[model samples]
Target: MQIKRNTALMVGVLLILAVAAWAVTRPAKPRLAAPTAIPVRVVSVAQQDVPRFISGIGSVLSLHSVVIRPQIDGILTQLLVKEGQSVKAGDLLATIDDRSIRASLDQARAQLGESQAQLQVALVNLKRYKALSIDDGVSKQTYDQQQALVNQLKATAQGNQAAIDAAQVQLSYTQIRSPVSGRVGIRNVDEGNFLRMSDTQGLFTVTQLDPIAVEFSLPQQMLPTLQGLIAAPTRATVDAYLGADTDNQTGDLLGEGHLSLIDNQISSTTGTLRAKAEFSNPAHKLWPGQLVTIKVQTALDKNALVVPPTVVQRGLDSHFVYRVSADKVEVVPVQVAYQNSDINIIKGVQAGDVLVSDGQSRLKAGAQVEVLKEPPQVIHTANAQVQP
Candidate 1:
């Protein structure tokens, strides 16, 4: 039994030794394949003149707006202008019932005529009295009494003439005329409606459409910059957009104008300053009380280095961009001088340097990159040009 045990142990040891020798002699596993190059889009840096603008919300206003009101209390007999009709200053807008005014004027004229007839008689009597007093044909007391009576009649004639003048002046107010040149708004009173001079709501409104104005507010910190523009020889230009979107990529432009005025005091609660601009609105596109976006060009930077806004990346400590060179990308730090919705003005990168615009997540320092070329745009041509 002992001899059999020793033989079995020797066989087991030899089998283990053979297995270890095979494991040591085997070939090593193949190395992992290298990572594929990341696909990216790149754009070359560009240098150009950039404009710096201050943006704010603005409201459209009319340069001349007036509420048409009746000067005298009377029934509105006729409306000469329809709603939304353009009219010039002093144009007939509406007519009030003038029959009552005309009658009052006639009465005043009749009173003046009666007074003049009496004054004529008084003049003749005064001449007779003077002759009698000179010749002593009558008593001095009687002549003096006649003279005083003539003077009283003359004063009554003057008072009647003054009443006639006042009546004529009031008659002129019966015709309602436009106070300014503008388009008419909705009517507050219709024909046959009695209007009063003290009515809070006027008959209608007229607002000047051409050469309109826009009011806007900006932060007080920008006051110095705005003052500089105002002090310049040429007036600074202002642009108004339709919507509140200040982003140039999406906002629609309404019109352009020149800076007109600035409020003397700033609002303490909001820390903002108010300003106004005047625009020639021949098309009447801008309306009163319309909210819009305004851009005021305050300064211009000559020969600024610009890049696509997407190329810039924010980091923990600073901003960065992946600069492409020789099919490799390197993380380059950049200082952003100014930025708009579309592009950014940078100072760290030089002009003509290529930058990666997309696919930045898989990038590392000195990482290999595959630049993607954009598909060519298809253009349509006229048949005549194509034939040639």
Candidate 2:
């Protein structure tokens, strides 16, 4: 039994030694290593004339707007214009019942005719009396009385003529015409509706479409800049944007305008000053009471260091940027001179300096950077090699 156990132990030791030799002699497997450089996209700083603009919410207003109302009390017999129709000044818009006014005018005319006929007869009688008195053929008192009678008839005819003029004025008021060249708004009263001269609500409104105005409000801090623009011989250009856009740099552009005027006083409650700009809206892109976004150019920074907004990052204390130097990046504190939604005018970076625009989340000061201007290089590590 001792001889069999010794033989088995010797065989196990030999097998263990063989397995150790095989493990040591085999080829090592490929292993993974950490990336040496962080992948990032970069941009170069540019020097150019950057226009500085201030943005505000604005409302569109028609330069010429009028509420068409009747001058005389009457029934609106006919409406000659449809809603939203463009009309010129003096274009007939609506008609009132004019039969009563016409009748009054005709009666005044007949009264004037009768009075004039009587006056003509009186004048002829006075002429005859004067001739008779010249020869002493008639009494002087009779000629004087005839002259007085003629004067009285002339007064009656003059009063009747005045009445005819008054009636004619009333007749003209029956035709309601457009007082301004514009587009008509919705009608407040329909045809056959009784209209009173004292009614505050009128038939409709006429608002000028072309050569419109936009009213905007800016903070009082921009007052000086606005004053300079208004006093300039050439008005400052303004741009209006549509919804979700705060400046001319983004979104849909509605129309262009020029600064017209500024309000005399700033609002104490809001700390903002109101301003107005004019635009020739021949296409009717701007309408009355339309809300829009306005961008008013305050100044132009010549040869400004311009960069993408994303290049500048806001830290807990101040703003900073990742400036690329060779293969490494360093954080550089930057001062923003002016910034809009599209670009930023900064002070710390020089023109033509390279900056890391993206992949900043994984980057730190003094970290290596691999510029991702092109596709990343692919490395195919050799599969784990084993040699017998």
Task: Give each model's whole-structure lDDT.
Answer: 0.84, 0.85
Please list the Cα RMSD from the true structure of every candidate, rounded to 1 decimal place: 6.8, 11.1
Q: Which candidate comes out best when scored by TM-score?
A: 1
lDDT of 1 by residue, 1-388 (tens): 9999999999999999999999999999999999788999888788777676778899999999999888899999999999999999999998888898889889988988988898788778778878888889878898788788778887887888888888888888888898889999998888999899999899899999998999999988888888888889999988888874665525667888989898999999999999999998988888999988888877777777877778899999999999998989999999988775567778788888989888998898899999999952221111001000
Model 1: C-alpha RMSD to truth? 6.8
Error of 2 at 253 (Å): 1.5
lDDT of 2 by residue, 1-388 (tens): 9999999999999999999999999999978887699999888888877566677899999888999899999999999999989999999999999999899889989998998999999999999998999899899999999999998988999999899999989999999899889999998999889999999998999999899999999989888889999998877988877773552344567799899999999999999999999998888888789899887876666787877778899999989999999999999999987765567778987988888888999989999999987653221111101110
**Winning candidate number (lDDT):** 2
lDDT of 1 at 241: 81
- TM-scores of the models, in the order given: 0.82, 0.75
